[model samples]
Target: MKINKEEKTPWICDKCNKELQLSEIKVVYLGGSFEVELMQCPECKMVLIDETLALGKMIEVEKGLEDK
Candidate 1:
């Protein structure tokens, strides 16, 4: 998998007011779990999702899945 560097430069947490850390997270949707790399707040562990994933692959895969 490839990541766009320009889209994921750096980020800070609004609640903690601290720099975010790059980590792999488990995201579950519709009874399915996926491991994705995201920027998260070290203090709060709040995961961040970018527009590329939200509007791109995330939505694409969502439409292709069934409840079974």
Candidate 2:
């Protein structure tokens, strides 16, 4: 799944003080890995997983993987 920055509020990286950019990120779960677009810091490479995604698609994928 692709995650785009649709929110009006921009996310900033606290460590780098830089605005997060929408880019493809590699996510690993249960020994599975996939790439998806997400907000991340270009300099620090810090990825942001918002509450909505954590509770929604992330949870769904985790459950689906665990069931397998």
Candidate 3:
């Protein structure tokens, strides 16, 4: 099956709010939800990593709790 490419979403630095265009950004899909993907803002390279890590931690915590 052919996957339709998603239109690029506007990306901004979470700390500085710097805007980035598609050419200046990198996206990695984790095979699911939008948040599961890594979005790197070239202008700052801040929001993407920061948000991804935060989400990763949240997932970890939830998994740990569930394993109990």
lDDT of each: 0.82, 0.84, 0.53
Off by over 4 Å in 1: 1-9, 66-68
> What value of lDDT does candidate 2 attain over all alpha carbons?
0.84
Better of 1 and 2 by TM-score: 1
How many angstroms is residue 32 displaced in model 3 relative to the true structure, after the best TM-score fit?
20
Ranking by TM-score: 1, 2, 3
Question: What RMSD, rounded to one decimal, does every model reach?
Answer: 6.8, 7.6, 10.2
Q: Clash number for model 3?
A: 0
Clashing pairs in 1: none
Model 1: weakest 10-residue lDDT segment is: 59-68
Q: What lDDT does candidate 1 reach at residue 15?
A: 100
Best by TM-score: 1
Best by lDDT: 2
Q: Compare candidates 2 and 3 on lDDT and give the better one.
A: 2
Clashing pairs in 3: none
Using alpha carbons, what is the TM-score of model 1? Answer: 0.72
Whose TM-score is higher: candidate 1's or candidate 3's? 1
What is the total number of backbone clashes in candidate 2?
0
lDDT of 2 by residue, 1-68 (tens): 87667857778999999999999888886666667789999999999987886687777778888899
